[model samples]
Target: MEAPHSIISIISSLLHIYILVLVIRVVLDLVAVFARSWRPTGPVLLLANLVYSLTDPPLRFLRRRIPALTLGSFGIDLSFLALWFGIVIVQYLLAILSGLL
Candidate 1:
């Protein structure tokens, strides 16, 4: 049987990867918003969609509970940043629990 700390360490690593992905997703969103004419072609769009599909479920769940920041018609989706912070904290805790910190 594997050690429990080892399992926590593995989970923490996965969460770190997810946090990185979320960062990339945020950059993509910003680019899309600011660059009105910019569009992703073939493979990039496919990967973006794939990332969106993976990340959206968690974001939607968070959005329902978390209020967004808005200025008139434009609003910032706070859930993604919230989740990013949350995962960071969780990962930190996991690192401690796993005795890797």
Candidate 2:
């Protein structure tokens, strides 16, 4: 029905926004590390908190089940990559369903 198509469209839009937020989270994290000041303050702090709250739950869920890959001194968090792929897959499925209806 048209209702289902509209719902899927909304969800697809939200997923796109979520993907952008996830990218910001990754960039902010790298910035924090390179800046040598892990504790952000004022507006930066607020933004950091907002990003963390939005992205942490799903990441934490995957993180708890899967550990990061450590190569010497460097470590890679697979959860972010996994979450990104998962979202893409869901978006693809939604697109297919939308096309069908």
Q: lDDT values of the candidates?
A: 0.85, 0.94
Clashing pairs in 1: none
TM of each candidate vs. truth: 0.83, 0.90
In the range 1-92, model 2's lDDT, one tens digit per residue, is 78998999999999999999999998998987898757778998898899999999999999999899999999999999999999999999
- Global CA lDDT computed for model 2: 0.94
Residue pairs with backbone overlap in model 2: none
Root-mean-square deviation per candidate: 2.4, 1.4
Worst 10 residues of 1 by lDDT: 92-101
